[model samples]
Target: MTSPLSGIRVLEIGDRIATAYCGKLLRDAGADVVMVEPPAGHRLRRYRPAGVPPSAGDSPFFSFLSGGKRSISSPTVPPELVDSADIVILGSTPAEAADLGLDVDEIACRTSVITVSNFGWSGPWIDVPATEFTLQAWCGSTGSRGEPERPPIAVGGDLGEFIAGSYAAFFALAAHRGGGPFDMSVLEAMTTSMQVFSWLRKELMLLEVLGRSTEVPSVERAKDGYVGISMATGQQWQDFCAMVECPDLADVPELRFQVGRWEQRDLIRARTADFFATHTVAEIVELAALFRIPMTAIGNGETLSSMDHFIERESFLSHPSGFRAPRAPWRMSATPPLPPALPPALGDTDSPWTPRESRAERTGLPLDGVRIVDLTAFWAGPTATHLLGMLGADVVKIESVQRPDGMRFAGGFREDVERWWEYSWVFHGVNSGKRSITLDLGSEEGRALFGRMVAEADVVVENFTPRVMENFGLSYDELRGFNEQIIEVRMPGFGLDGPWRDRVGFAMTMEQLAGLAWLTGYPDGLPTAPRGACDPLAGVHAAFLTLAALEHRRRTGQGQLVELPMIDVVLNASALQVIERDVAGVLLTRRGNRGHEFAVQNVYACAGDDQWIAVSVRDNDDWHALKAVLRQPVWAHDLIYAEDTADLIDGHLADWCKDQPRDETVSAFLAAGIPAAPVVQPPDVIDNAALQARGFFQTLDHPLCGPLPYPRPPVTGHFVNSAAPLLGQDNAQILGSSLGLTAQDLARLEDDKVIGSWPLGL
Candidate 1:
């Protein structure tokens, strides 16, 4: 079968997860990707899971991300190859690229160039060093993770790099369509994961107004393991009560409302804990599903590997280790992704390729002429529109006075503040670069207005459940009547058609249900949700898929319904475990801070209060470097130490780290060529030298929130960086200009509450 990106040539020059995964995506899409590494092979090839030898070609980490691509041992790119490639992805710092004679501007002129770096190429701290641990901290994700009292803990796995690669692939594809050169910073992409905490911090203002604290727990221990539970809506609360056989608790005055339940969190936790103590994770999962409650067991690698759902879906690829690896995230009916193949040996150029001249340059942003009608609220849907807007699409965000986006009222600071809608950072963060208008779709006049706008829109995107558009007489079929060429992208939690289609889906619940919660957290601890990474993750997928659909439309002049299941997106992101279960019949479980790929890997406490550093020894080379850095400590000479005595190794390492300052220790290890980094917190991230140098954060002046620093899109391109529109801020402009409504008409509409600048009662 033909692939979507057939005939596309992608040249990848990098050695870590970010560039490797990006190349994998393009290769899966049928792009001819050639990965260039040194003669000794890339450092990433040495990364092997415990008991797996590098020579065995069974390093799950490498096999999973580096498959389906050819490799060369050239340290430098051939000018002829660079000129002929469709896209060139550079995974290097500006200095490194310069040293290799890879000129950013020169290569960009020849073909689409995506430069992925720790910070960025032209930033002040461009030379500063970074690692997954430091980047997560710098992105504000680390500070918001873990228990409140405990020191901040970075999320396991290379999440920062993973997110960066996703953005790189998306942007590279966009650039391939004449978007131009783009720079991607791993630190910036990781910040998207912290959007939830950014909102929660503002929500703390509301807690202060209510005379309550800002602490709340989202996870609880079950009889056998941990279960993630969320009672966000009244119905969910009732379902939870029913599932737990505590209908009386649901009726309690203090538990009747979300805020009340939160205020009495201690009591709620006590009661819930007592009830959960009697139920095993499996029992709770069954009950939760039966009652339609948003609950799921914290899954370990083992459980995820054995899931029947993944096996039935054929979500894994067989690896040589007698195991499986995850496949591509999305499925296309017409052009599916390529099957996984083993990575090529260094300098292996056996694959055939016909080099072609680069295409002519396009003058504007990739989506400059595209028009999108956005009806999304909260995180995931809005994220898609926001990204589209940055790509230069004319996005009209349709909201209503009576039912404004829940995000407008999310941050706590708005409760006692005037013009609270304008002051919501949560709303502003995702809604930036898009225009907002008010129209109550439930009303005939509002529906009529939307129909008129739909006729001129190229795409209509929404995240409401399946029936919402149908209820409003705005389903894809109905909208196609308004504009036959309009693309409708529907983002539902489970999917447009499924057993759980009608059920409400939230990031927390989706994470649990999709098996991310099961894969995260400590092995013996409760399954924990890492803020809301799934939301942004789903949003990124939604945006990438939308672009792909647009490309199809460009080819065939055809528009169709695009349904992106949030659960499916999350499942794809957590694809590693599916392999373990399907191929080896072993359920993957959590290993806490312990590393599965290396014998010596952990986070150790540092000299200062609540400070720590993450350390990982990839192989004997890293181990020897660490030993030298530690001045040949006695534990380093132990015979059993080389055989995966991780606990004993970590204990000794902790003792050494506790007496050393975080930065000095990390720097020393790094100098000794060891993989180590200081654990970063949010405050430090805001002022991080590397990020600051790269100008990763941009300041937007808002009417109410004043000037605030917002992380720029991880991708570099000719895109707009603007503040979010105020509630209904663009009603008059959009209605008057696009729909040809007169001033008097807009005035009357506002007077009738159909279009208003401010939210109701604000």
Candidate 2:
């Protein structure tokens, strides 16, 4: 089957995770992408597991990123190839990119292009090094995450950068069809990624002014487990009290009122927790449905993976590489994309053209010439843009002098011991492909200049606090006045209107208010936050939304507001969990890494201290396997009908599992047709043989961060390909000539603080 984006060509250069993933999306849509890799490949190639066999001569990163596209050696690629490319992706400092003769202005004169960078080309820290963790910290994500006392933990799995890149891809495609070239900002991308937090912060500010509660009710602990109950309306509150069989409590004059309960929140929470402890997980979930309160169980990666919906929907696609990767969040019907066979080996194919499709014709390209202008920061917003970029949009990231996005200043402002891009690993992960150009949009002249750029852009994406845009007179109204056809995405913590419009927040805080954090810890312990759950969850939603909006624009000439509130998106994404609460009024509590609905389930210790096995039995058939593994019919019999089956099962299973070898148990379960998985470490995930068998990991001989490993595209469709991009490495060709900028003019822009060079220092 032909792909939706067939007949599109994308040229990706530089090191950015978002751009790379975005390129993969385009390839999936059947785009013919010429991924121009540096002499040593890219940084993503060096991301290896603890004990996996490293990439030999070729890059292992390809197993994840290079599935359907053609690979080309960057420094050695023929110049004609550059000129023939339809869209060029760049993500380097302005000066470094110009040195390589791939600047956006230069390429724009010859063909369409997109520029992506840490800050837009004009920012003060344009040349600073960066990583995803640093950016999360600087953007207030760390400050609000975890216990609020521990140092901020980076979100797991480089998700922040991935999100930024996803959004970049989304807009780039629209821009390509709309016009010529554009620029996207990484900072803006990150900010948009935190839509909910940004909105909440704004709301809190307004609340402070109004002299209302500045914070949501704080939850320190719960009896049954941590939980969050949101009864926004008076009737809902009344219903909730009744559902818990505590109607008497509601009759108390002070308790009867929502405002009053909030004032005495501590007492109410304690009372609520005590009530919840009496009920089981099932009972609470069912009862919440009866009362129509918004409630959900606290879950983790395991829960997300094991959801029946995801399994039935085939949200995860098995690869030749081993591990099953997730599918793209959004699915399209018209031009359904197919997943590729596997990631590419470094220079896996000898030529740019496969026998099936020649480079000269550029067949199989999904998005032929889409373009995007990215102005965002953090995770959510940038993630959406990156997805778009991956699908064959020319994504350009914009930046300014104010604080550069945090990712750009990672690694203590110094190069790593190896002098590689290690410190900037996070930056490279998110901002690949596209071009880089600096434009200080905060100044009057800069804003005017941006207005001109907007005239030529298809989509403008940002995640600034609502005030930032207004302060610079670059609000939606002002932007639309410049170009009504442009798609503008305004992502705040809360929506534009609300009582708490200016509250300060981040993913951690959002998780708490939205009830996620409250439900994640132990049943009797404080709430716990995941390493980086918010970024990926919010990013996936943003990506889904942006793509849907793009399709809407394609069908209609009108371009309207795309408002994604982080809190709202999270709430919606978690609707499955909350629906029961909203309908039944049963309060939810934390289960502490445990699952429900399975008579047999647990994470049991294995031969090693850290090694463990997660196994589950849904019916009698699996129970038989459990019996076989335990080799104890009497113990199994006791569990099946004992009055205290849970205790019996725990005791026997604990002893049995503690002495068993993890691999041996896993094998026995697989052999017996029981559902089991290892409680994997990062290294375990990175090195799983199953993943390798599925051709999941990609190998690349990166110039910096040497021989990195990257995971394959999570989703595979009917038509799919995966390709990553380089840094602002495509600037010269994109901005210098393609945008009609003269060499003299380009030189002047460089001197006038409009665009700076790459790798500025340390």
Candidate with maximal TM-score? 1
TM-score, predicted candidate 1 vs. hidden true structure: 0.87
Give the per-residue lDDT of model 2 (tens digit) for 1-762: 335456667777776676777676667656677677777776656543211333443333344455666777656444566576656666666876776665567556665566676545553445544344334433334333332222222233344555556545654554445433556555445433422232222221222111112122233333454444443334556777787666876676655433466567666666666667766644664566556554444443234335443455554455455444444433333344557456555555444542223222233334546567778665556665665565566777776434344444431223224432223433444454445555667656557667877877777777776677788888877888988767777776645555334433345545654445544444555555442346545655555445544555576655556666665544432322332332233334555433323444555667875555666564677666778877766757645732236556766776887888887877677677666655442322334343344333455444444444443223211112222233333346666666666788767766765554443333
lDDT of each: 0.71, 0.52
**Candidate 1 per-residue C-alpha lDDT over 451-552 given as tens digits, one digit per residue, 9 for 90 to 100:** 999999898989998888999888888998999878888888767664456666677776775566664566666566665777777777778777877777
Among these predictions, the greatest lDDT belongs to 1
Global CA lDDT computed for model 2: 0.52
- As a whole number from 0 to 100, the lDDT of residue 559 in candidate 1 is 77
Considering summed lDDT, which 10 consecutive residues are worst modelled in model 2?
203-212
